[model samples]
Target: MLSKFYGEIFAILTSVCWAISALSFEIAGKKIGSLPMNLIRMSLALIFISIFSVFYNGNIIPQGANSEQLLYLVASGLVGFVIGDMLLFHSFVLIGARLGTLMMTMVAPISAIISWFALKEKMSLWQIFAMLVTIAGIFIVIYSRNKNHKKIEAKTKKASILFLGFLLAFGGAIGQAGGLVLSKKGVLNYDAFSASHIRIITGFLGYILIISFTRLWKKVFAGLKNTSALKTVSFGSFLGPFLGMSFSLIAVKNTSTGIAATLTSLAPVIIIIPAIFINKEKVSFLEILGAFIAVIGVALFFI
Candidate 1:
């Protein structure tokens, strides 16, 4: 019973970690291209997850992972880590951090709906309504800043950038949704921690492939001396692939994909706490209201 409760807690923790990672990586990606940052962060994540899984589970590779499971995990790692993060980081470059994260809220519903069809997971009417409300909240947040003429004028010339950012974010949403379903399939027979290690291994390989095609390996080596940036990437890696992903797989194992994803979307709100206090960003009533609505939508998943 305690284990089950902790599982749920870990699921929520996954969201918090994701939020922190997104914010931190956004800052790092601004200095370095998303591809280079991805290579660094994923490398750190692979090493950290390997160490943690070995210490906790006494095994490195996922036990009983068959060919099909391996395929699914590899696919998941490629799409989620490679395509998904690549696009997401690009979106951060195209748009500002807040808007990029807001757009990414689509990941939960997209993944949830896809998981339902692909995995034949069930959802209650209330859950569907909750999803609708969550999307509504996201839209409100996006448009909420529109009412400010000054803000609009400031970002007006960059409309094209915002459009591309939206596209990248949408692509990432699809990748994350698909990745979750695939990971669910791949981890069906293994411990969550071990499954995480497998995913990280594939993710590491995917980044390596990116380096092969783009020759970004040299760039990554050059930027390694930026201690502050490297530290930020390391922090993001620790929160993201190491802890966030491990808990996410555990969440999907214990809960429905839709529920787990919706719950995870709470990251945006968690981000606000840091943004307001740490970043010293101003908060508006509408943003606060939108956050409240999103939280309510997340809560509806349990009902």
Candidate 2:
């Protein structure tokens, strides 16, 4: 019973962690460029996760990871960390921070649906309706409330790269969905901590491969001098991959993947409070309505 309660708490915290990571990366990406920022931030996450893994598990390598499990972890890392985050970061560079974040909110449903079909998990009729309502709420929230659609007009004036960013975010979503399912499958026979370690190691290798091919090694090292970026990314890593992601795995261990994914999707709403205070973004009536509707949908999911 305690573990279940902890799982629910952690699932919610995962959304908050995601919001923090998104907010931090948006700031860092503004200065360092998305590509460099992606590599640097992910490396920080890898380092943080690795250290935690070592201290907690007494080893740096993946425990009980066979050849097949290693391959799955590597693939998961490549798709999620290397591909997903890179594209999402690029999106932040293309579109303004808010819109990019709005787009990312879609990932949860995408992941939930994919996990459902992949895992052959069953959902109740209410759960399906709730999922639909949640997705509708996302659309409502992202729908421009500007009298003249200022957000869209502004985006049109910016680089066309925002579309690419959306595509990349979508790719990242698929990768993440796949990673979750694969991790669930592989981790069944191992400790969750060790399983997470395997994932981070593979993710580290994926970033390394990208850095080599893109010739971004020099800039990455130079960017290391930017103490501010390092701090942000390091803090984000601690919240995100180390604590947030670990808890997500624990959530999946306790609940259906679809339910867990939906619950975690609440990050976007959690983000609104910060956006208002820090970024000084205005909240529209529609957005407020969407938030309430989404919250109701979340409640229905657990009914």
Candidate 3:
């Protein structure tokens, strides 16, 4: 019985891990800025993953990964880790982790759509409806109305910042969705942990290039000296890239990409209570309702 739902279980675990890491990254990013924090996070995560790979795969590097596998997995890393997470960490700085993670709920539907085209994955009409329902839930959380039902004005600088943050989050969703499809293609029948190592290796290299070209070594070095932020980033890296991402690959390998993605997208819902308590963010009733509705929509994928 447990074997049958292995993919789903791992995906749910991934959500929990991501929720914690999202809050950690948010706190750290605010202090060190997104770019430097990302480089450091990837670096720490690479160390953690390398150690795990040594124990599990008997090597620090992924063994037996062919050129085709390397191609797709490398693309997944560049898109998901380098591009997607860069945008996401910045969004967390501007919008807070709760709202930023809420926006990431879009990853489910986006991944499904991308998988359809890229991996020949098919979705039924019911699944399509579920996707729409998920989008509606996200819309409810992000958009607000006045007492008279008027839309909020975008004139304020705060509003503008929020808009940009949400846009960045959306771009992250697209990158992550594309990455999921590519990971599915690359990791079929491959060792999930080893596959994760490959993705992280590429992502680490990508960030190295980005930091070098942008000449952000000073910022990166500064981030290292901030003990508080460094602790947070290190913890987030352990939860995120080392564990959460490896579990996600296992999920996609074990089940349909759509289902796996939907389950993993539960981070928003999982993070709500922690966001309220740990992050000390005020949670409105509407936000709670919207999260539940979104979860309901995600649940429909199982049926």
Error of 2 at 21 (Å): 2.0
Q: Which candidate ranks first by lDDT, i.e. highest?
A: 3
Residues 1-303, candidate 3: write the lDDT tens digits: 778878878988998998899889879988987888888999999999999878886898789988999899999999988898878877876765556666676787889878888788887888778767766665555442121222232333387888898899889888888899899999997889889999989899999998999899999999999999999999999999889999999999987787788778767667777878877988777777878787787677566
lDDT of each: 0.78, 0.70, 0.82
Query: How big is the RMSD of model 1?
Result: 2.9
Error of 3 at 5 (Å): 2.6
- Provide the lDDT at 269 for model 1: 66
Q: Which prediction has the highest TM-score against the true structure?
A: 1
Ranked candidates (TM-score, high to low): 1, 3, 2
| TM-scores for every predicted model | 0.87, 0.85, 0.86
lDDT at residue 252 of model 1 (Cα atoms): 83
Please give the clash total of every predicted structure, in order. Answer: 0, 0, 0
Q: lDDT score of model 3?
A: 0.82
Name model 3 segments beyond 4 Å from true.
87-103, 142-153, 157-169
Predicted structure 1: clash tally? 0
lDDT of model 2 at residue 147? 32
| Candidate 1 lDDT tens digits, 102-174 | 6666777887778878899887888778877866665565556545742764556476766788788888888
